[model samples]
Target: MRYVKYAAIRKPTEECIFCKARDEVGKERENLVLFRAKYCLVMLNLFPYNTGHLMIAPYRHVPSLEQLSDEELTELMVLTKRCLKMLREVYRPDGFNIGINIGRVAGAGFEGHVHIHIVPRWNGDTNFMPVIAGTKVIPESVLDTYDTLIKYTHLLRE
Candidate 1:
């Protein structure tokens, strides 16, 4: 809920990524976005630490968690749970790293809107490449991951 100054500067753009995805429902597949709903959308992280690094972001174009209504907060949390379910079914990951980066200094990529991250993890998933080359290995391509997740979104709301 900490208001960051930089978010104010980036709020002018009409075609914000979250807004655009909200308008285009199933087209998330084209954008590597795994799923989209009324209050939030799930999109793959272009630069991820693991294979299925996805973000659940609110549809409203606002910065900081404090800006969200109680209903919006409820929907966002629901979408977060759905994301975890989809990832569990598709990736079968042993664990997950889930959180939010609130401000620019706190590593919020899109500081204009608060989002939750759900990153799937597995045993021995990290290797020498990440340690030595500063590159994390992803077993599947973003598109493939998108396809895998999109297939499971149908059962998510249940």
Candidate 2:
């Protein structure tokens, strides 16, 4: 699976992938972390549904938003807005699919660490590739996308 591409780095032994990304330092580029806020951080999705796909998660290891304090919740949404603006500025996508999956059944890849997904969509971006060949093509590489967006990290700070 394309998701497994990150397994070598986000090993099963790690307590939580998001926590690891939150704690680990000096590897922002390698980890695809674009920006770090007081309560949340932004990073490109390793197995993105589309180009410029990004995920925003709180620094805390809470599994649900209800567990987060008001400050955390506020910053989470604030950062989400920043991400949307940044994605729009950089990718100029036709539309977007923004959501949070709370559980495994709900499509949370990391059920124990809640996060929001921001997927950029274009008209007719989805084609027969996935239906026929069982593969989705991303026009740009994740690292390349990170590099392209990293310059705009300052937007999140403001």
Candidate 3:
């Protein structure tokens, strides 16, 4: 990963979030990233409820789902299913939350382009931490999770 320093305070350049990831193939110490393809890529969420929380995003920058072509939509769905399958195989979550947030008000962290979130859920996965502390407890680090998923990208293609 190329390091970008702003003034005296250094921070990863946010020129284009996806491009930053694209440029650094092996630089990220975190293992949360799972797969990358021509049209889309999958990465484990740094903060997640369960162990495997993945996000699938398009290579092209499109803010709304309406901006995506039929082919892009098709590919997105296909990738989403594959992600779910791989998560099931690895973590065996009982259910999943799969959808896209069109705008910031809709809960899109990155509003420039629409991406799909695939969150795995097990029975009684929600607990007091979320209800009381208002924070989620994730057992694994994003980097470790990425390494695990990267090892299983082949199964997703199949």
- What is the Cα root-mean-square deviation between model 1 and the actual structure? 5.3
lDDT by residue (tens digit), candidate 3, 58-145: 7778888788888777788888998888889998989998878887577665667678888889898888886786567777777778
**Residue 44 CA error for candidate 3 (Å)?**
1.5
Over 4 Å off in model 1, which ranges? 1-15
* lDDT score for residue 23 of model 2: 90
lDDT of 1 by residue, 63-151 (tens): 88889889888888888887788788888999999988887688776768788888899998887986696566678877777777777
Candidate 3 has an lDDT of 0.72
Q: State the lDDT of candidate 2 residue by residue for 1-158, as single tens digits.
A: 46644543465445776888899977898788988888888998889999999999999988899999999999999998988898899989999999998976786678789999999999999889988976799999998998899988888887
lDDT of each: 0.75, 0.87, 0.72
For model 3 the local lDDT of residue 23 reads 61
Clashing pairs in 1: none
Greater TM-score among 1 and 2 belongs to 2
lDDT for model 2: 0.87
TM-score of each: 0.84, 0.92, 0.82
